[model samples]
Target: MSNGKPVYKLIDGKGRVLIPKELRSAAGMDYGDIVRLGVTNGRVSIRKIDIIEVGDQSPDAVKAYVRAAFKTMPDDTRLSLIAELTELLKQKKEV
Candidate 1:
């Protein structure tokens, strides 16, 4: 898949397409990896999602990472996330 050649694939009845092993390797995708799918200009794109373990990070570092991530998120998603976090904090205080 890394040879700059296009590989043809057929979508199954359930609309699932099998990605070849070479293509997956080229994209650095492995089993159990999270992926984000999006459509742009009538073409579908797949992106590997990166997850950071905050348990091992310092509070300041985590905050900085979160701020940077929030900057990349859509305004609606950021607002929704803020609302969800506020609700969680309210519940925690009640507990």
Candidate 2:
């Protein structure tokens, strides 16, 4: 395809487009994942709104890591982790 961009796909009767696999992978998207779509100047753009994976240390590394981790985690797991972290923070504050 031109400049490595995926070519067009026919939209279904229900107005859905099948996103290409390579494009999805490049954007870190997978099945069942939600994508954020935006329209600007009559053109649409997409971004992965939920994923903010941490790369090796940058200024906001911890924030990115926690954000990504939270996106895929179940509510129970998130609650447990938050509870643990809260306990640790409370201990630190008390010290």
Highest lDDT scorer:
1
Task: Indicate the residue-level lDDT of 59 in model 1.
Answer: 70
Check candidate 1 and list the clashing pairs. Answer: none
lDDT of 2: 0.73
Q: Rate the local accuracy (lDDT) of all candidates.
A: 0.79, 0.73
The superposed Cα distance between candidate 2 and the true structure at residue 84, in angstroms, equals 22
Residue-level lDDT tens digits of model 1 in 1-95 = 67799999999999999989998898888765656577999999988766545474867546645765776799999999999999999999999
Candidate 1 overall lDDT versus native:
0.79
**What TM-score, to 2 decimals, does candidate 1 have?**
0.52
